[model samples]
Target: MSETTSKYKAPALERGLDILELLSEQDEAISKKDMVAKLGRSVNELYRMLAILEARGYITTEPESGKYRLTLKMFELSNKFPPMQRLLNAAGTEMAKLSEKTQQSCHLSVLHDAEMVVIAVQDSPYKMGFCIRLSARIDVHGSGSGFAMLAFQPEDQRRAILEASETPEPVIESVLSQMDKVRQKGYFIGASPQISGVTNISYPIFNSNRQVEAVLTMPFLTLNSDSLHHQVVSFEESRLAVADAADNLIHAIGGCTPE
Candidate 1:
């Protein structure tokens, strides 16, 4: 007689929901190892779900830090819920206006669990625009929105989120060193680490709970010009416009932005 070995099985749906729930409780983001310990699931089981979530824009991984977090697409879906429709409707108008005014792609994204998913994007009036995929997700470490979300979190919680990532320890350490400045600046501006030539600036959106629930970002290309003086002036102007629009968006959304 031949002996047989048993294989382990995981409940796919249950595991996905469990991962979301565990992440929800965290103020910062959580790492895969921490998830394994906290959720008591195997690494293979966790990686499968994480891959799905990351692909679906439900979660994002920070490239520099290799951490994962929830995204704002969650709020967009939740807006379909009867209780949230009114606020969502109101925010949509403001999002559109901001996009028009800035002449750069504008995104209204919210955090679901620990990820920031794009709920809305407004195309710029300029022929050259940053056209992002609808519901696209970017990691909390690479974009302005991620910085905004990370900045608002409590120190201990933020540290946990940073430490929880699968990123090599050295990379995490280097990124954490700059986090303090990000927190103090209230927003961030830089080129897209994921995509070449795209520059972006973003600010946090807060809910009644005073927690960062979402982010509004303006992504555009820095036009290459032979006239260095003109290029410098244009960049400065665009940055100011984006900043003003972000503040206006915060006021327009009020407490319903998310928490």
Candidate 2:
């Protein structure tokens, strides 16, 4: 928490938020006992908050297991925010077009607290394709989208993001070198660190102030010889297509790319 935020405390609200955050991080619904142990709060203390959250439709309890899990309410609420809504509207058409053209899956990601959160995704119009789930959190040092956005940030802002990263110093140094290459090329094309045989191509989307607002990434997959949907465009063509889609989104939002 920041100093400014700490000055005003709302204990009840904090407990509610803490519960939500903890649930969001879990892969499966968690029991109240586990929640109490993880949050360091008594079951009595969290009981009312959990009930309120469940009542408000932010979370739900499984009837069989009696465990708590998040609902789609938060994601739906976030989509209603005007700025995020606008970004989605601008990217939707272009992202679809890019996926259709390249026959590959693509996603748009924005920086959030030193991580990249996937906001929108478009699956390829092919029988076999890859798609990342919405709201997926990606490591800043491990994704091409992260490098594309970080490489274009102003020196001070870039330094701040790097300073906030938990990556080891040696790995950070190596990532910095890659970012330099991304800056020189004005985009990123690299093998994915998390998945094998998939190349990542990413371009930075800028706002009116010439600051990077998001990154558009295409996870290019090579088709097997027996696959029905063979690659239509060359690798360079798909990369350029992703760049064009990013540019189109910027134009749609009345934004600009830096010279």
Candidate 3:
């Protein structure tokens, strides 16, 4: 079956939520193998979700027993995520509009340490399009999402954000060289360094505090010559549209463009 129509998608997400709900009722560590059995799924099926949970600190592993257990960190983060939730709620429709207008998929990403975490995505209405996985972590130095976010932050914060990254020296220098150009243009258009035949166009979303909180991106694809959607909009069209959409969302969430 095609990935978009696969029955695995819904249940896989259900399984991730199920793990947290099950663990919240337990007081002790549970083995991975046992969780597998309790989950009624193969280890391979649960591996990715479990790793994401562990990395995000919703669960912790015991070194002695190598078992997993719930942590209060998720609760702590839940308290701080209301604003983020608000942004997603406000931006959803606008993002869908962007996809409809540009015939390209777009995603919203924010800095998490040195990585960019995709928090929201809207797929193009076209039969075929790019879509980034929500909660996916992207390398900050080599990605357009990273460049948009990095270029907009104030100088001090920019340095700190860059310092946290462990990108190769050549890549770091390249990104540094591109910062001013990106800021001057007020958007970034770069080759998807990791994905072939895709262009990642990114713009920053600012808040009333004048802080660039998130990057909004459109991964415009190079369509097959025989593709259904011909005469797709140019990169500049997608760029300008996303910039306006980002600004609208910023205002929707009580933010303003930085001066």
Question: For model 3, where is the 10-residue window of minimal lDDT?
Answer: 1-10
Per-residue lDDT of 18-110 in model 2, one digit per residue for the tens?
A: 998899889999999999999888989999999999999999999999999999999899889876787899888999999889889999999
Report residue 103 deviation for candidate 2 (angstroms): 1.3
Q: Per-prediction count of colliding residue pairs?
A: 12, 0, 4
- Write candidate 3's Cα lDDT for 1-259 as tens digits: 1124455568777778878877876769999898887767799888999999999888989999989999888756753787787788877999999999988899999888788988889988988898998778898887999999989877777767777776766767777788889999888998898889899888888876877788899998877656554777777777789888987888887887766
Question: How well does candidate 2 match the true structure, expressed as C-alpha RMSD?
Answer: 3.0
Q: What is the TM-score of each candidate against the true structure?
A: 0.61, 0.86, 0.70
Task: Return the number of clashes found in candidate 2.
Answer: 0
Sort the candidates on TM-score, descending order: 2, 3, 1
The models' CA-based lDDT, in order, is 0.69, 0.87, 0.83
Model 3: lDDT of residue 251? 85
Give me the displacement of residue 37 in model 2, in angstroms.
Answer: 3.5
**Residue 253, candidate 2: C-alpha displacement in angstroms:** 1.6
Compute the lDDT of residue 105 as modeled in candidate 1. Answer: 71
Cα lDDT, model 2, residue 159: 61
Better of 1 and 2 by lDDT: 2
Candidate 1 stretches greater than 4 Å from native:
1-77, 81-87, 163-165, 224-233, 255-259
In candidate 1, residue 209 scores what lDDT? 69
